[model samples]
Target: MSQPQAGRGTFITFEGIDGSGKSTQARLLAEHLRAQGHDVILTREPGGSPGAEEIRALVLQGDPDRWSAETEILLFTAARRDHLERTINPALAVGKIVVCDRFADSTRMYQGLSRGDLRATVDQLHSLMIGREPDLTVLIDMDPDTGHARAKSRQTAEERFEDFGANLQAQMRAGFLSLAQEFPERFRIIDGARAIDSVATDVAQTVSTHLSSVG
Candidate 1:
């Protein structure tokens, strides 16, 4: 992990293909940071704020082909705008670290790469509408096959995204890795294939190091 300048609230996000345990790790890291006496808010994307959550259901449920890739991107961007204004920005303004399960990066990978070759459009929309990035993005890297197996075990209406299958997961993994390379300063690529505790410990240590540097 690398150091970031202190003096403001930290924004951290966990990203990976579905079933990579990003949600669990996000929760663990939040609890760890809270126990250490830091103000922390753990949230997720496409649905962080109330309005975003409604969008979450709209995007995650229904038929797999409910919305075209471009339209889907719009919905996600709209939800993200709501989330940033109502949830993320407010917490950061109050000097509280925000641990989000997913952020714009997921949109970059899921809609940008996996769903279709819409990376250019995704980037354009992000730059125009949501230009913020996390202070630290912990990417839980793992094999797509493992992620697919794990995702299958937990059935939900959100299966729409998961229906992309293993091939897309592989593409998403590579997309995330590319993001890590592009933003080395704030991206922490963790080996998510390891045991839960091991990965948790590594994530916690990375967060602690960044906090120490910034604090």
Candidate 2:
């Protein structure tokens, strides 16, 4: 179960709403890369590091009334900071390709939708914390209703943001599209509504081409 170690590798992150298959596709890409004799490290956000996992539980546990808007934002950022130091940056330093399930972009989507004046917050946070952003962000766009349905099918009880309401989710869908448009060079927009295989194919092709270009 040891992954091959390449001389130098890239950092890739998959971002999307729950059930958009970001995690599944992220793993597939890492497996493909690993099979190709590349150094690949796969991890997920809000819980990648040990400290972050504790925060992740609280975030997902749904003490909505107890957790304030600002508290939620800080907790998320705190998790990301830990994730960066404990996993992401270290892997990148070792020339290992880090294929992360989610990253800072989720903050922009989630906190942005939850709070107002998102544009300003994103810039400040980027400059203050996430020193380096993902070279490529694969955004799987999907409807919240459909995604929630699929996510629920696999789980018994929905927790945390599962109750984020239709309006907030609708904003997330639009926000992701707008983000892709605004940062086309950094984002690969994939239609997550497609069949699993179809979406995987699209992502593989895109990542392959990108790797070739960067290589």
The true-versus-predicted C-alpha distance at residue 30 of model 1, in Å, is 0.4
lDDT digits (tens) for residues 1-215 of candidate 1: 22222326899999999899999999999999899898999999879899999999999987878999889999999998888888888888889999999999999888888778898999998877777789999999989999988997799878887886888889889989999998999999999999999999999999999988987
Candidate 1 residue 130 C-alpha distance from true site, Å: 1.5
**RMSD (Å) of each candidate, 1 decimal:** 4.2, 4.8
Which residues of candidate 1, in runs, are more than 4 Å off?
Answer: 1-7
Residue 54's lDDT in candidate 1: 94
Candidate with the greatest TM-score versus the true structure: 1
Error of 2 at 90 (Å): 0.9
Taking the tens digit of each residue's C-alpha lDDT, what string does model 2 give over 1-215?
Answer: 22222224588989887778899999988888888898899998888999998888887775445576556678888888888878887788778889999887788777755565565666576557666678889999899888776665675343566566556666777887888898888899899898888998899899988989998
The count of residue-pair clashes in candidate 1 stands at 0
Q: Could you say which candidate leads in lDDT?
A: 1
